[model samples]
Every structure is written in C-alpha cells, then in structure tokens.
Target: MPEQPAGSRPTLEAVAARAGVSRATASRVVNGGAGVRQPLADKVREAVEELGYVPNQAARSLVTRQSGAVAVIIAEPEFRVFSDPFFEQQVRGISRELTANDSQLVLLWVEGPGDHDRIARYLGGGHVDGALAFSLHHDDGLPALIRDSRVPAVFGGRPGSGSGSGAAVPYVDCDNRGGARSAVRHLAGLGRERIAHIAGPRDQTSAADRADGYRDVLFDADPALTVQGGFTVDSGARAMAELLDRRPDLDAVFAANDLMAAGALRVLRERGRRVPEDVALVGFDDVAGVAEAADPPLTTVRQDIEGMGRLMVRLLMRVLSGRDGREAGAPASVIMPTELVRRASA
Candidate 1:
C-alpha cells in the first residue's frame, strides 16, 4: 500500500469504503440524520471510530443545507445574561431540549449597538439552521431581519411595535398579561386595594404585556392606583420608594418580575414597612432562588420555561422541514400560559 502524506486526513469516501456502505449513507450516519438502518448505521459508526473520521460542516451543509445547529441570540447586557436566574432557567430548558434532538445550540450575545450588523451577517451566512431570539427592545429590527431571512426562527418574547413588523413576528412567550392578572388578583383577594406595580422596561414586549395585565385587572377594581418601575433592582427600589412617598396608604405592590420584587422587598425592609401586614407583594417568573431566599418568601407567577424551549424547537423544526410552508400571513404568534404560585408575600 502507498503511504499517504503526513498531514493528509481521512475523508468521507475513506470511511464509506471501510464500512462497505455508500458515501451518502456514511454522511447521513455521521451527521446523525434519521432513517438509516441500524446495522448499516452501526457499521458506519464503527468505521468512523476506527478511522477517526470528522465530518466537514461545510460539506454537510452543502448536502443537507442544514448546519445541524440552532442559534439562540440574546441582546441583553452580558451581566444580566449570566446573572439572571430567569435567564439561567431559560438556557437550561433550551439546552436540554436541543441536546435531546442531537442539535447544537449556539448562544450569541449582541452586547452593543455595533453587534447588530454582525448578527445580521451571521444569520444571513447560512451557517445555522435557525434562530431563537431574546431580549429584543422596541425598535430593534432583529425580528424583521430574521423573518426576511426565510429561515426557521422563533422569538423568546414579543418584540414591541416600534418597528411595525413586530406584530407579525412569530414568537413563543408566556402569558405575561394573564400571569400578571393572577398575581394582582391574589393580592386583591388579600384585600390590598392600594396596589402598585414595579414594572419592567416599557420597550420590551414582556414588560408591556405584564403592565397591560396589571392595568386591565386594576381597572375593574375600585381605586386605580399604579406606577411603573423599570425592570431592574435599582429601578424597583426607586419606584417603590416614590410610590410609598406618594401613597403612604398603599397596601400592596406587584413587581413585574422576581428581581424587581426582590429589590422592592429590600426597600420595604429599610423603610420599616411590614410585609403582608403593611404591604402584600407579588412578582412574576417564579425564579426559584430569589423566591426561596426572600425574607418573607415570595408569591410569584410560574411559567414552564423548559416546555417553551422544547415547543419553540419543535416549531422551528417544522419550519425547517417546510411542512408548514413559510408564508407572511400564517399566524405569527405562539403564546404559552402561566400559573400563580402562592406563598407568604401575598
């Protein structure tokens, strides 16, 4: 036998010949594609292991037109991405679901304004199968870009109507409005009329939806008292303090999320306001850690983030398969439900 060059590498044909299978079958087996017979698949796997065959992503993409990878693009601050428990849970859910399907998850962080164009290029590059976008602001054109790409894509939450195209963007989101209502209703059940809201950023769809829920519920109740606290700890503290100053008679508060609620709780303690006694409080996204660690514990709304991740993947997979046939008017919304978790706070 002739000796190959020192740096020469094994190719798909080499593995196919060794496995006694066609190159196409070897390719399918190596790329984890379905429908391959078990014995042939095992032979290809054994051949791959013996020869140390590594499949070229470019070649695979050429044949399958799929990179066997999905991108999860998040535009939040890096600190928030790493530190937020809600984000942690979301990542876990997404990871678990994607891994089960033998697909890769690419986490892209779009930190500054400069990152937008680069993100567009990455998505347009045909290097990924699809995308799951998160943390988009009101005016960000990401939704439209993803839609126009004609690639399978799903949003983590609704992007607001700042760009007009947001209304038609396909997304998988928790029922923020309904969850917020449940939280408020629970507080109302405890006879807390002077309820205030520590809301998230108005630009975000989740924040806006949550605010709408609180507003909708409060409108039906007797005195409509409310305020907005941008979705941060400091914002919540400041907003809670201001609300207390304005309405010392306020008896309850509904923070739009658990982080904001935690902040409000700290302020209440500092101001010597008794929890549940003086002001019952409720929060959204029952982030397990903060809920358990809160001074008086917390009552919160819980959404199955893992289920959302799995469902988003399934939807995107359907889009990838061309089963639904992507069209402009094919129902651009996928809303998930939420539930209230009662505890000492409310």
Candidate 2:
C-alpha cells in the first residue's frame, strides 16, 4: 500500500508500476480485461485500488478508436420531446442498457431542417461511436445522412427509403398496422358500425401503417369517415370535430395515439356523445397518464415502447460487435408484437 503525495490525479502508469506489470496489461485490465488471465487481472485490480488510478477516457479513445458513447438522435422539436411520454419511456430503456455497458448517452434533437447540417456534421465527426434515431418523416433527411456518414446506427421504427438503392439500416419497430387492425376489429366486435378513424400524419411510418390498417377494415366504407390528425391533443380535438361534422351518425372512433384519443374524448364530451354507449372508442400506444386518465379508462392497443428502445440498443451492440470481432454476427431489423388491452372505453 502506497500513500499518494497529495498532488495530481493518479494515472495508468502509476498503477502499472505498482502492479509490477507492463502498461499494456494494466490498460487491458482497466478497459475491461478480455485476453488477460484471471490472477494477473486480479493483481492489477488490487494495484488500481491501492493507487486510486483513473483511466483517462480521452487517451483511451485514442488507443481503442472508440468514443465509448452512443448518440440518441430524436427528430422532434423540444416541446414535443418534453410533452410526449412515448419518447420518455423509450429513452429510459436506452439509458438502462447503456449504463449496463458502461457507455454514455449523448442526446441530440432536431428542431427543423435547419438543424440537419449541424447534426450531419456531428455524425461525421466521430464524437460518439453510434447513434439511435426515431420519429422519421418523408421529408426528413436523417435516414439518408445516417447511411452516408457510415456510422453504426439503428432506427426506432421501420425506416423510410433514404438516398439511393443502397442497403437498408437495421431498425426495431412494433406491429403498428396489426395493432390498428386489432383496435378497429375490437370496436366492430362490440357491434358498432360506421367506425370513423382519426389518423396521424401520413408521412410518419407509424401513422401511415395505422391508416392502412383502418382502410383494410373499412375498405369500401364512405371516404368521409377518415380525418387526419397531427398526433397531438389539439389536433385530435380538431379532427374529432371535423369527423362529427362529416359523419354525425358514426358509432365508433379509433384514434392513432393515446394523446389524440384523449383529445377526441374531450370533443366527444363537448358534443354530448357517450363512450361505448353511443360511440365505442379505441386508441393506440396506451401511453402513461393519457390513456387511463381519460374520462373513462381507455381500452387501447398496447406495444412495448420501452422494450423497443432497449431492443434497439441491443441490436446496435450486436452490430458493433460484428464490426469489432467481439461478437460474430449483426442483427436484422425487428418487429415486435402488439395486443389489445380491454378497458372501460372500448
């Protein structure tokens, strides 16, 4: 045991000298010992304890050529990122896995097209080892930019086409179309006819897929029964009003997400429509606080939002492993299952 002359921070060199091992052996032990034998690794650990040695992350990055951090790029503005519980839950999952792997999470958000240049520059700068992005739209250029930057990246949903006909980036998404079909079918089973749909913006993959599911169920129904929404409470309220104006006799409503569903519920109450009595209602995403807190608890399609985020990180780790020879294979894109949860609203 050596007492430090109270001075500067301890370095790897000091730990190596104390352990009677080369700087390289101490380096391997400090940076998660892999090829080193157990007894020698233990000796390095004891030396590190006695010397209180700390590895310099910047220097370590130069040695390993890995930043030891992962970027989480969300394409939404600041307000929506703060308001929406879906992103919150997904980020929680990502943080949990990143902590386990001793990696850092660098959060990057895009407010508009103007921010793309800054984001593109950062991705190419190698500040983080990889990135996980979501909430893509048709006009957003992140998908293509991510591809061209050649950084290991994963999408949170089924990706839209980016750039030319090159290979598709891996992604983790839920069964959005199947979930919407299940919700609409549930309403139909309850003997409600003329079910109207309040759909999300058509540009997003989730929204487009949900709209397709609604059409699949009501293929030959009147075109006026569907209205577009912006996946917001205010938009839901506005769309709900429009639907009533177009089809006052409709007996059911299916909202794309829980926030919109909550908004639609407000409009329904304002218009003096009863839930499941006059019009059966269902929504998707089963978001926390929004769904159950509705006037009557909502029966909606449930997807594993946090689980999807966690799975995205796991997939990215596999890809990183394949690149670095730690793991043997990369993963293909994943689509998780969804289910209908029965509650009072439906």
Candidate 3:
C-alpha cells in the first residue's frame, strides 16, 4: 500500500507497525477476535486510537470467509417492519444476542417484486454468515431461494407456502392458532355474538393459523361467525367496514394483528359506533403502539417477539458451531408460547 500524507486514514499495516505485531494480529484484534494477550491487545488498541485506524469489513470478510455478521430478512414493506413494535422488539433481542456473541446484524428489507432474486444472489455469494427469514407468503418463492443457497438459514415461522411438512433448516415460531383461539374464546365468553375476523395474509403461517383458530372456535361457538382481512390495518379497516355494511348486527371483530385492529377501531369510530358497547374488537401481536393507543385500549394476543429473535440467534449460533439441536436428533420446531392480554376492547 502507498504511504499517505499527514492526516490520512491509517491502514492495517500502520497499526501492526505501531503495535509491533504482525498485520494478521492487528486485523484479528480490530475484528474483535479472541486469544490475543492483554499486553499485545492493549498495544494494538492504543495504536488503533493513535493512528485512527478503521478495519474494512469487506477486506476482513475476505480474509475470514466469515463476515462476523448475519442478515435478518423480512418479506414485507420497510415501513411495516420498522414501524411495528414487534420488529423493534425482535431487533433489540437479535442485537442483544448477536452483540453478546461478537457478531453483527444486518437488516435487509425485501418488499418490491423480484427483489428476492437479488437477495438470493447476495446470500448465495457468501455475503453473510447465515440468514434469518420471516413473514413468507405462498407465492413468494423465498424458500426455494434459501434452499438453493445451501447457506445456513432459520425461518421465524412454519412455512405456510409449501407442501413440505418439515424444514431443511430449523425454525422458531409462536403458537399462533392457540393464541387466536384464546382471543376468540374470550370474546365468546363475553357473550359477543356475530363475530367477524380480520385475518392476516393468507400465505403466512401465522396469518393462516390464526385465522383457522378463530374460524374453528367461532364455528364451534356460534356457527354464524366469519373472517376476513390480510393482516394490515387497511385490511382490517376494509374488512370491518365491509362486515358492518353486510351484517349491521355484527357484535364482535377479531383482527389478525394490532395494526389491523387499530384500523378496525378507526373505521368503527368513523361510522359512529362504540367499542365494547357496539362491537367488541380483538387483535393479535399485542404491539405496544396500537395496543396502548387505541380508543379504549386493545385486547390482544401477545408473543415474546424479542425472545423469538434471541432464540433464532441462538439456533444460528448452534448451526455455525455444528451443534444444532434439531440436527443432533432433537425436536425440530421450537414453538414459543403466547399470551392473551385483556383490555377494554374485548
């Protein structure tokens, strides 16, 4: 490398020379690798500060063949993932675990059509240590991409898109159907009949599973209830609005997520209806913003979003360490539990 004039950035060689160590040692120290002694490590640290050295991630990735990083891919709009409390909580959990393990987290937002192809290329090219995929839909073709990559991957939920019962890679998921059932059953217990459901996207396992739970319990309870919604607030609002138009006597609504439930409430309020008095509403995901900010508060099904993120990281670490529980003849699906939070909505 060419020597620079005064005030230029320091290279790895400069740090190595200043620390009286090899360039490789300087690189390792900068990347946070273990095994360097305190004296040498201290020298490298001091030299790094004195020289204002910064390690190039791409160069380091080439040397280690491990980026010291992982990617979290969500198949949804950036706003949806960024705005939702669930994503924020999960990201915090994921970051906590990754930072503890000395790894970095990279987030990839895949919302546009044909973007999965680009993502597949990126992952397949060995850009990340592994990948964590979430919110897959039926026609998304994401599973096939990950399957073809041969890189280690962990899904957030069971894939509702494919016929395959089990995953080639391990997955962590919440008990969606059970949670939905609990929410709907609670509404029934409140003596609210003519219930309508604002469901999640049909392709997502959480959405389908939750919708199924609501449908099964509602049919068993009243046999006249129905469901609709695609897990968005707009979907919830539209579904709620339509249900009200069709069945003016509908007394209850179950939304697939808090955002959707919030939408349903807005639509209800707009049409001059009272919540819990005119129509009881329930939502899943117990997201903080919508759950707490609703007109009369929201009754929602809650999952440990942060725990899920941490658990996913743990599973990936196991894979990287070659001690994966499922691969070691343990149970495959690690299903996390859910809770129903009571509020004024239902």
Candidate 4:
C-alpha cells in the first residue's frame, strides 16, 4: 500500500479501496454496520483500523437525521443544581446510559421563567434528538414549549398540572405518595399520634404527592400540622420552627426530603425534643452524607435516584427510536418504588 502524505486524513473512498468494497458498503459498515454481512463488515473494520479513519459526525447526522446527541435540561436555580446530591446522582446515571448508547449529553440549565423562551428556541433548532427535563414546577411553561417544538422529551418527575393544554409527557419518578404513606404508617404503628409533616414545594408533584401520602394516614388530623418548604436545608429549618410553634405537642414529623429532615433534626435538638422519644422523625430520598449523618441517624424513605435517572434516559431513547410507537396515545411513564430505611431517628 502507498503511504499517504503527512497532514492528509483518510477518507471513505480510501477505506473502500483498501477493503476491496464499494464506498457505499464501507459507509454502511462504518455507520453501525446495519444490513451488511458480517464478513464484509469485518473487512471494512480492518480497513478502517489500518487507515485510522474516523467518520465525520456532522455529515453522518445529515444522512441519518439524528443529531447523535441528547439534551438534559435542569429547570432550577444554579444553587439547587449544584448543591443537591439527588440531581448529581441522576445525571451520573443518565451520562452512563448515554455513553453506552454512543450518544453525546448536552446539559442545559434554565434559571427562571424568563429563560423558557431561549430554551424553547434551542430545542426547536434541531440541535438534539431528544431531551430529559428535571425539577419542573407545576406552573412551568417549558413542557408545553417542548411539546410544541416537537422534541421528544422524558421528565425526571411527574409533571404538575400545568395551565397549558399540552398532552401528558412521559416521566420517570419514584413512588412519592407510597413512600410518604409508609413513613406515616411506621410512625402510626409506633403509636405516635399528632404526626406533623414538613413538605417540599407545593408546586412540585413529588412534594404534592408526599403531602397527599401524609394526609392518607392522618386524614382527620389538624390541617395546621402541615407546613410548606422549599426542599432546602434553610427552608426545612424554618418549616420545622413554624410547625413547633403551631403544634408544640406534636409527637412525630415526616420531612419530604432528607435535607429538610436534617434541618428539622437541628431544631428538634435545640428545642429539647428527643427523636423517637418525644418526636420521632422520618425523611425521604435517603440521600448519602445527609440522612445517615443526622444527629440520631434519620430513618427515611429511600428511592433509587440513580435508577430513576437511567430510566428517564431509557424512555427518551425509546421515543427517539420510535420502538414503541409512543405517539399513538399518552406517552408512557415509569414510577419506581421506594422503601423505608429504619434508623434511630424513628
């Protein structure tokens, strides 16, 4: 074989000649080798290796009509995006799945409602094949925008009842309502009445469902026992303080997430409330470095956050591949189960 000059790159034609196959055959092998015989594919692979040839992604995408990339849109503040371990774990799972499928992951952060227009424009520009959206509030307009743009998307949680008329999108979420019920039942089984709840943002479906779970067990309980939180440590602390003031005789508390539970624990200790003694505590998400490290160790509800993230990717891929004919009806969603992790806090 003649050696090519320095600074010259190998092309499909060159690879085809070396492999003793037509350029179309070589192209088919390089582009996933579909419909090509194994022996021919092997020959093309050998030629590509010998010539050190790389397919031009841009040119290939034009032919396949696939960008070979997926977008991960986080509709939250920068602080929450970075500070929450939940998001980090979910992203890790998504990244792994996308890598396995030979796709690129593009992360887009939406700071507030004002950024929705820009995000809609980006999705409509055909820059990615699909998207996985997270941390969406009930009132968020981004979901409808995504629908209108015709970008296949999978949400990380059950979307809230938005004001728009867009059809329901597929989502992957933990069993928030069931988990909350389990927490409340455990406290009830322990004979702890007057159980109070510190709920996350009301607009989020997870928080709303969790609050619903709390009520499932305490339907007849006082409405004042429930307080709203922002799913942050500070918000948890403030909510707990208010709960104490509203119902000082409360015997137990179930925080929506572990971060809030941790905050509640701090106030409980400061106010001389003994965990599992005077006021049993339970949190959700079982986040590492938070729940287990709490003062008395929190007995919380555990959800497979990473698994949820991976499921989101898998669902989006199905939509992109049109494997299940997703558009015939409502997009399918997956609800992962949760369990109660017992500890000293409860």
TM-score of 1: 0.81
The true-structure Cα RMSD of candidate 2 reads 4.7
Best by lDDT: 4
Model 3, 12-118: lDDT tens digits are 99899999999988878998999899899999999988877778767866776687779888877897887667778888888899999998898997777678778
Lowest summed lDDT across 10 adjacent residues in model 3 is found at 323-332
Tell me the tens digit of each residue's lDDT in model 1 across 144-191: 767666667877887767544422446789999999989888888888
On TM-score, the candidate that comes out on top is: 2
lDDT of 4 at 23: 97
User: How many clashing pairs in candidate 4?
Assistant: 0
TM-score of every candidate:
0.81, 0.84, 0.81, 0.82
Least well predicted 10-residue stretch by lDDT in candidate 4:
322-331
Task: Report clashes for each candidate as comma-separated counts.
Answer: 0, 0, 0, 0
Give the per-residue lDDT of model 2 (tens digit) for 179-205. 999998999899888999999988899
TM-score for predicted model 2 compared with the true structure: 0.84
Candidate 1 stretches with Cα past 4 Å from truth are: 1-53, 163-169, 220-225, 323-332
RMSD for all candidates, in order, please.
Answer: 5.3, 4.7, 4.7, 4.9
Which residue pairs show backbone clashes in model 1?
none
List ranges where model 3 is wrong by over 4 Å: 1-64, 163-167, 220-227, 323-331
